[model samples]
Target: MKPNGWIIYNGNLPGNKFLDYAEMIQESATKQGIDMKILKNNALLSLLATDQLGIVQLDKAELPDFVVFADKDIYLARQLELLGITVFNSSKAIEISDDKIASYQYMATHNIPMPKTIVAPKIFTTGNIDHKLVEKAIEQLGLPLIIKEAFGSFGEQVYLLHSLEEIITKIDAIQGKPYLFQQFIPSSYGKDLRLQVVGNQVVAAMERVNINDFRANVTSGGAMSVYTPTKEEAALAVAATKAINADFAGVDLLIGPDDKRLVCEINSNAHIRNLLDCTGINAADYIMEHILGVLS
Candidate 1:
């Protein structure tokens, strides 16, 4: 008998990249003689109803053989796991990958060679800036340091502080949020590598370069082209993903001046559109296969 599979997508409906990936998974599963269902609903609410599990439509819950999470819905993923449903990239991994500071700390502790980072104290109310702390970080990490909010995506909240003045100004404006200050690796040249890892394997990788801007996120207007990673690069990316216990992920690595590769970040719910375009690899198929394997 074919295994029944379910993909939980954002309820926002079609036109979203996540939904597109869900559709591709459905198509791929069908080709492999598997029964696949795509449920476009509020992921959090869907997991609450025990009767909705195997049902494809509304208001049904039964234990699904496997649940593939396409959105960064960590809360719902955890609930499903509690119900004994197998989930790809488990909730614990998602939580770790979502926080930049945690991801860096995890990598560094595992000897993954991440940038030197200092975590700022949690801010409650805005007041005088911590000039002393900022000066200390600058003195240690030096100029052109990178400042990032603990939780950010698409390079939206990352900043390159070129001097102490910029650091103080940005810190003053971003009070009440924890930030990560790290040494900036200039060899990236506004370019970084995004390697897609699946089930402890690196399926594809691309070099995302931003000529006009410093951020390498495609959503930030960066351009992605295919780049074949060396054996060490591939191994590092795979190791980083495994270190975080992610079943599937996109690992970002920064190449330093001495040709040293540093693990920068990991995306649990990785966006595969750009990687697909660059590598011509059907990542959705890979994910579907993994889900089915788990169920089987």
Candidate 2:
């Protein structure tokens, strides 16, 4: 029997981007003769009982054979797995990818090349900045470095520090939040490569460039174009994704001072719209194909 699937997306998000992701996947699944449903995560509740564990929905029906989880709600994903439904990207991978610090830790453990980094000490409260810890990081990564909050996306919580005040302002603003400091790769100042990996291969790649900002994220005003990744770049991206135990991911890479590839970041629930627009390749098709193949 052909498996029935549900594409779960976050309903709390204000914009349509999250919904758009689920729709794209549903469309791809449809084209391949697989039946799929788009369900908002909020529509169901994950609950645990003394002797039972399952997801509850108001208009509840049978559980899907597989779930295409396109949100950061790890608990819900894990809850589904507990009931025997397979979730793409898996909860462990989603947990690691959702937190930049955790992602970096996994990357470092596997010998992935990246910029020099320093994890900030935990501060449970605000208004008290740790000067010594901040200074040590600056001393190691140097001035004009990158400060990235451990749990952010779209380049919104990332900053390039040039002076004491800028660093202090950012630290103060995000105090009590997990974050990190890293060396800035000037060579890749306004650009990076985004490679979409499915299973063990890279299906599509793009180079993003921003003339106005240090961040090269498309949402941060970066322009994108289709690009071919070198063998080494491909290997690094594939390795980085696997290191974090992600089934599929969008791996960002930077060109280091030594002209070698350095891992910038990995996105577990990477939006495929941009990749499709830039490369005219729908990554959703590849994702659905991978899923169907695995199940088969």
Candidate 3:
């Protein structure tokens, strides 16, 4: 029998982007002859009872054979796993990917090539800026470094600071939030490559360039174009995905000095629309294919 599947996306998010991702996957699953459904994360309530752990939905729908988790609701994903439903990019992978610090730690453990990084100390409350620590980071990383919040997307929470005052001001504004500092790769200031990895291969790749900003995210006005990744690039992207135990992910690589490729970020539930627009390759199809292979 064909496997039953559900694409769980965030309903509370403002835009249709999340839904769009679910619909894309659903469409791909349909084409591949799999029974698929789109679900909103909030629609399923996780129940932790004395003798039973379950997911409660108002419609009383039966659980699927597997779930394509398109949201960051780790609890819900884990709840489904507890009930024996396979979750793509499992809860642990999603949790690690959702937090930049966790992701970096995993990368370091796996010896993934990345920029020099320093995890910021946890601050319990706002207005408590650790100037000495920030200075130390600057001393190690040098000026014009990058600061990234542990949890963010579309490059919105990443910052490039050129001075101590600017770093302090930015940190003060974002105190009480988990973040990290890293050496900025000036060679990749206006450009980077995004490779979508599925299973053990890179399904599609693109280069993003934003002459106007340090960040090369498409949402930050970066221009996209189809590109071919070198063998090493493809290998690195796949390795990064595996480092976090993700089934598939969008891995961004920064061009370091001497043409070295450094891992910039990994998105567990990366939006595929931009990639499709640029590469004419729908990652959803590859994802569905991978799921079917795993199920078989």
Candidate 4:
């Protein structure tokens, strides 16, 4: 007996984790006596509007049984929703998780502990980057601040400024783009925990440590290690995920001074390799199970 649904992936076919997970899901479904097909977004786009609905494509004319978004492609996900397809994490969840400042506000509103931070406007039109704005944030949140580009992945455009001089230099470089000025949580020591959440449950976790650099992203030469999170840590991770309405998410937490924990960032399309390697859990399998359950 063949199953009736397909697993839609949001990335290219080869050399990408998204594709890797797609293959894993297909294999898992095969074991469960379910028929599964892996399709890319581009391929899915071509078959849209037809009865033979393609599972993978950028433009989905008809609703699929389930769709997995790789990054924060909210517009496409919403389009599929309009077609009556059940998206794993709705477009609205992705939007909130993608925006760093918005996530912080959401967490704070929910009484979740988070680092004190400020969001600078997207456009700085005064021809003068307000030093006071940064200074005030520092005054309230304290020094060793982190200035981050609002929408970046794999630690590409994050700047860690240890001194006021560095902050000025980095702010000047990013003249007119929205960014965040957040107080650095020193306890992380260039390391943080990336916890996986599914259906608002914290399923797996890993500690990413960067010994040579300040950024703890695996792509940026960080080492991953397994760490058993405390009860408080796990609770916070789950709460943060729920607050953002993320069906599947990578939640980053920084251990702050006084042995406290602060929810730093939430990633919509979290990397599966690092967490799989660290925790020895097949994240792909977990995701597929959740998707299958939803469709069933």
Candidate 5:
């Protein structure tokens, strides 16, 4: 009998992007002779009581052998794991990959080459932030720094500030959310590389460029072209994926001064629709192959 699996994605998000992601995975699994289920994150309610943790699924369905978590709901992912089902990208990986500060911290300790970064000091209140802190950050990173919120996607919460006033204004808007300031990579301005990694290999790669914005996210109107990563880029992406303990990831890389690749961010449950459209390669195929390979 074929092994049964579930692909869970967030249902609260609008439109078909999430579903598209699940369907792609499902199609790949189907072709590989695995039985796959597509479940929305909201469908499984985490019912917790003292000394007991379980889920209340709609229609009281039987649990699958493995779960491919395509959502950021770490609690639900953890709950599924508690039920003895394997979650690809695991709860820990998803948690770490979803936060910028945690991702950078993990990579920094692991000797991953990246732009210099400083974690923002925690601010308890919406009150005034010390100007000195910003000054110190600027002194270390210099003018035109990058401000990125710990929790955000599609480059919506990333900012490039060229002046002190811009820094203050952005900080005031950020409130107390966890964020970090990073040195701007001039060589990577409006461009970066996205490498889709499965197991120990780079499955697909693309180069994204956006002239209108500093962030090179497709949602930010960045254009993507099929790219062939260098040996170093491939190794870095694989190492970063392993560092995060993710079964699969979309590793973003930036070009450094000498044309070397620097780790930008790792997406555990990365969106594959864009990668598919750009590369004519469905990362889902490689991901399913890797998952089944490991399980076997």
Candidate 6:
């Protein structure tokens, strides 16, 4: 029998784009002759009781052989794993990739080349941050730095500050949240490479450029173009993916000094629609192939 699987995405998020990602994977699975179901994160509840510790399906649905977890619902991912169902990207990997601080720290141990970063001190109360630490970060990272929140996507929570006052204001606003201050790469401003890696290889690549903004995210009005990766670029992308123990990921690379590459971020459940439109390479197909290969 062909393997059946589930692609779970966040239903509460305000867009069809989340479901769009699921449908993309579903189409790929159909082409591969596999039975794949798209599920919302809220559709199946993660049950945790003394006697029963598994999924609680309201409609009495049977669990699949594997799950394509496209959401950052780490607890549900863990619950699925505990039931012996293989979750692609895995729960731990998703957790690490979701948090910017964790992503940087995890990549650091692997000696991955990235911008200089300082983890912001965690505070319990909002707006009660230590100005001294902010001053220290400014001293170490210098002016024109990037302040990024730990739990954000689509470059929405990232800020490029040019002065100590701006940094202090941004920090004060997000004191209780997990964030980090990093040295900004001037050469990489408004330009970066998004390399989609499947398994151990880069299956597709694109360059995002936004002349109007500091962030190169397509969601932030960045334009996408087909690009070829150098051997170093491909290797760095693959290494960053492996460091997070993710099966497949979208690795963003920044241009450092002398045209060197630095890891910007890794998305475990990266959307492939833009990649397909830009490079004519459907990462969803590669993702399904990776899933089937692992299952077999």
TM values, all candidates: 0.91, 0.98, 0.98, 0.85, 0.98, 0.98
lDDT of 1 by residue, 195-265 (tens): 98888678888998899877788998888888898899999998999888888899999988789998888
Q: Give the CA lDDT, 0 to 100, for residue 202 in model 2.
A: 96
**lDDT score for candidate 1 against the true structure:** 0.82
- Writing each residue's lDDT as its tens digit, candidate 3 over 1-296 gives 99998999998999899999999999999998898888899899999979989988966788999999999999999999999999998999999999999999999999999999999988877457867998899999999999999999999999999999999999888888989999999999989999999999999999999999999999999999999999999999999999999999999999999999999999999999999999999999999999999989
Write model 2 residue lDDT over 15-70, tens digit each, in one string. 99999999999999999999998899899999898987978896687889999999
Best by lDDT: 3
- TM for candidate 6 is 0.98
Clash-forming residue pairs, model 4: 3-35, 41-57, 41-58, 44-56, 44-57, 45-57
Off by over 4 Å in 4: 1-15, 44-63, 124-126
**Model 2 clash tally?**
0
CA lDDT of every candidate: 0.82, 0.93, 0.95, 0.75, 0.93, 0.93
Lowest lDDT 10-residue stretch of candidate 3: 122-131
lDDT of 6 at 10: 95
TM-score of 4: 0.85
Across 85-129, the per-residue lDDT of candidate 4 in tens digits comes to 777677888888877778887888999988787887665745676
